[model samples]
Target: MQLNFFPLNFQFTDYQITDVNYSDELLLDLRRRYNTSHSFFRFGENIYLSNSDSDSGIDIATNTTSKNVYGDNQITASLIKHIFFRTFKKRFISYTPVDFYPFRFFSSKEKDDLLFDLLPNQLKGRIGYKKMIEVQLRLATIAGKQQFGFVINIARNWIFEKNCATLNLEGYNLLNVEVLHSEIYPGSCGILAPNEEFIGIISEIINDETAKVLTNEGEQVFPLTELFIRKTKFNIANYLDFALSPDKTSQILNHIESKKQEIYNTKSLHTEICEIAKALFSSKLDGHSIEFMNKDGFYFTVQDKPLEVTNTFDLKTPTFIFDPAGTKTNNNNPDLGLSNFGPYDSISFDIKSPSVLCICHRENRGYFSKFLADLKDGIPSSRYFIKGFQKKYELTEVNFQINELSAFTLAEYIRVMKEWDQEFRPDLAIIEIPNEFRKLKDADNPYYQLKGKLLSYEIPVQYVLTERIKTYNEYILNSICLQLYAKLGGTPWVLPANRSVDREIIIGIGHSWIRKNQFKGADQSKIVGITTFLSSDGQYLLGDKVKDVAFENYFEELLNSLKSSFNRLESEQGWQEGDTVRLIFHIFKPVKNTEFDVISRFVKDITKYRIKFAFVTISKSHPHLLFDPNQPGVNGKGAYIPNRATNVFLDSETCIVQMLGVKDLKTAKQAMSTPIQIKIRTPQGNYNNPELNDMLYYDLAYIVQQIFSFTYLSWRSFLPAELPATMLYSNLISKLLSKMRNVNGWDADRLNYSLKRKKWFL
Candidate 1:
């Protein structure tokens, strides 16, 4: 009636064969196995024993199955029924049906085999199964050993990259992509700090020039204090280097490369460059002065006065001197003709009255900042001195702007002077060309293009102290020496200055070469001869080093520098000089590929053409400034009247003459061209209305004789356009008059024709 189940020892022990209903040991063992396999479930209470034939019995059919479907259906139906058993097994069973109760209870061993059918299929039982799952609970327990090991690995890599690699990049928020403070370094005390700009201190041990002395006594020691005091030389070679971490350096390099094309394509930093340049020009040049202001102070001045001249050609401004020989005049007369032109005299204002008023241009700020900082450090004082201009001349303060990209912003600067100095009508104006002009083209212009832009006003301007050089030469010392004399106007003997024949001329050629070289290269000191050029037509050329002797030198330096600096750069990724050249030049050679001769030719053609068509208005009178084709150097030289000659004959009869000393028809015509010629009336020359013949003869002859004396000079060959009407080479009219024959009034071609009166000789 009572059944006890226990674990059975399956291997036979020799004992009487009495089969009990249950053994406690066997039941415990079976129960333990069941709990191990299904620990996720627990029974509510003890369940009643069931007879083998009870309703909870197993269906005996096996290979000959009856009620269930087969395949997936049969498996699924079987699973549903097993699930119910699992549910029912959880509750206590107090009774069973009498039909099943009338039978003996199955032994524990027998029941184990029978209950195998109710057991969950192994594959299905494991599906969708979960045990315990609060993750943090295990982390706090000793059982979570594996998870703790994982977190440590992540921390190590973060620390390594941050400290060892010196990577500038910091951890970022992966979700929002927000930048984190990881870019900053954390201090020892766990304090966060911003990125630092470097304060580098270089310590170098100097090798003593003098050997140390050892005293014979060996006790005496000479302290290092008296050893030697060679100066310490430490310059921040590249300021950007201080803060440049490897990552940051790489980043910047990448950025630069990516933007190379864009940067070169852009004309200027901003449009302000052009606007600033235009703003410097004066609307009117009635008064010739300009104003300038800077942080240092403010000042102004009238432009240089016009040079006085005895002849019309004396009015000529600076230009490439062509005449080999002529009477030289006072050097102070800027227009006095001198073929041996060099940077002999560059006008400089007394420091006290420095023409360079204020440094108002924005681009100048960088220079001023360094200047002011250096001044505090005793740097500027050692390099420069200041003095005042003479008090007699009045000055006008001017202000203006120029864009960074302008080539001829210099004109705008001059124009501004003209407008401001309108009152006294300053004869000379001074201006500061912006440093922006120093920019070398990325790719030099092709077709050797010559380009220039006009200022706001059409005021005439010239270059001062222009220099050019080529890639293969170096002539800096000479240039500095000349610049000193030309600009500072002081002896530069200390700089080892030596004068040579055609030095200026040679330097000028060199200067062009240097400019071309610079356009092609990168050295700064290859510049050569510096000079100015002008024409009688009021074309004033005043670029610094206009005829710079060292231009070739500078050009060469530029080319070399460009090659050295850019040769190694990869071509495909970013900007290079090649790109710049390609953009500007339809055809270009690589920096390393261009030959010196090729560059030189390009520069010559470009410079010549740039100034070739240059129309000038030297005088207000059209006749005085007319082009003379007959002159071999019409465009290059003879455009100006010859020195010492008041009358410049454009043609046999048409001429430009000085106001004073009119002589004959030619002299009279020349006088007509004077801007401020005085009208002279002679007793016989006036009859209420002076006849052209009378004015040309008596009046003109008397005036010339009185003013010019009896000085008869040899006649110079006239310009081609000034060819005489007659083939006679003689200056005498008698020879030409001999051809005329006396005739009767009715048949004479010499009979008075009213048309002769209307047609003046010209």
Candidate 2:
């Protein structure tokens, strides 16, 4: 058979995860309703709207789109408070137990030095400042996190004016004067009298003529025309007004940025890695005969034939299994749910051993856990929990009230719940992360606490996924497949009990990329070690998974990290004194030159230890698609047509290894994308080590077999994912780090030490 070899020359760089350019869906809807022409919209530097859209687009969070009408008519900080702060009073009074401040705005003083001193001298003389009102606002607690902010009220208006105008009354001990006041409005409140005076900080601006003011007599609403104010220097040192400073927003985004970066780096790194690999065909290496060892001294390998890889595993094949009642219905709408389909023939696997499930959930944590526990061997055929949670138990969306949470959030919660009932303590604690948890912007996020609390339990914690209260459909036989896999410890990915690979030591590496929270408008990134690491024996090492932000931009720091990882792994896993160790790095993206340099330095340093490693990348993101040479196209299951073990050498640098392929299927909509590209790189190749190059094997079938097995061992998902352990590890660790960083802040010292060799993050 003829082989095609492709040359490698790809552009690679530091992949930065940026904010999602969210199209203004609200604006789009508004435009659709009003039938606004596209040409009517004109974007300017400081506006999300055009001149014609006056006062229409006000984003309270940043006030970035706020602007005065023509003639430079602007209001002072005090005036802004009376007019706008009253609209957001409820937010300040009883702050929600959430991290994002969607309603906070920039204070007027921040944008203009004139702190509510907007009245001209002539106007101030007309309405002399005499009465003063002092408002005391008790700070609100955010999910128990104390926060400070202030509001200033100076001018009041009586009408909504296209050219709203106002002359500020003279102030006392404090401020300077700037910005004209216009865009006056008249409503239920009477017009302000030119002679009205002494009505200090307006607590609420009600209509045009009415407003509540905080005087020595306490809060009372008076006619706006009767209100007046003087100069006051309010000590607003630590208030997090959006315009005053970006510190609060920065803090929020910074927590999520790490998480986002970890994801981006993992994907991009995988891409960069696979394309750069060079094939090192070792003539003596056997591709079919596999032999591997486990810690138990047992050996394993592929038997007579490999099992078929289908979209749904055997446990999930419902083609033959049907509803006992043979019920009929309209098109299968998931929203209508599976209830109408009648009694579904239960799909059960031989657990062989009795097992208990511990569902670590949030929100109605205990209730949710109990719900899953009640399901014993069955999944909900209907979407019951989501529809009537509030109705049945008064459960609201946000769970700021920890006591009312009825779920496991803190270690105390776990203890309390378990002690309350023996049923709460299961044999395996599955931290089935709730999807909503990822939307959080703080340290209180449940993902940050999953590890430190659960691993201490007497039983095993086999991490797995369940469908959301809605369908959490990552795969068809999700819950069952995961359950069986957890119980049996063998999948299609596992080799026969009698066979094993020939390698003595196998190393797997994964990468993580995270970014600041995009919603917080802070987008910094870091490559972290909170990634995956595995051995050939399908085992995880604690030290290897000891995650930290990878030192980037500096080769020296990366060098230290490399040394640190190997040292940690060697110490924890008990390295063999003389056995040959194979290091395999699985990256989803390509590598940058600088990153290559770091790897080069690492390889050179490791030579002192005489370790043989292959820095390889396996990517599924490229444009390249592999198909069968004989029969190409769709399969009966709607999966693509490809031979079960098709191997294509696109070039000397790349090979497409089809691990679990099918040729034809008509039962599904889309065919499975089975081919994965593998590329290998050597630090010595860049170093000109001819001897090192000779020792490595470049067999496509061999590597493919290892990768296929790796996919089956994922601790997270039910089915074998497209990703392997090396890349998968980083995804898990980076994700935990990202979430934990939000709650724990930047102090990872605890994580480094307390969880140095613990699988707590899982």
- The candidate scoring highest on lDDT is 2
Q: Write the per-residue lDDT of candidate 1 for residues 398-486, one digit (tens) a residue.
A: 12222221234434443444445334322222222333444533123110111111111211112221222111011222222122222
Q: Please give the clash total of every predicted structure, in order.
A: 128, 86
Write the residue-wise lDDT of candidate 2 on 1-762 in tens digits: 111112211122111111112246644543454322110121322213221213343332222222222112121112222222232332234421111121222222211222223333433223212211112121222123222222111111111111111322211111221111112233212222122223335555555545565544556665544433332211121111222345643553343334333322212222222221111111124534222221212222212111122221111111211233334322322212222231122222222233444444445465544444333323345433222211111112211111222453465445643553554444334445556656766567655554434433433344434344334332323343333333232221222211333233344444444554322223345655433455564544433433344435434544565677667777776766654556555666544554455665565555434455555678775433333333433433422245444555443445556555453222343334436767766453265666556445565445555665666555454335556766665566566556556654344445443244333433
TM-score of candidate 1 to 2 decimals: 0.16
TM-score of each prediction: 0.16, 0.41
- Cα deviation at 334, candidate 2, in Å, is 30
Supply the global lDDT for candidate 1: 0.21
TM-score of 2: 0.41
Worst 10 residues of 2 by lDDT: 156-165
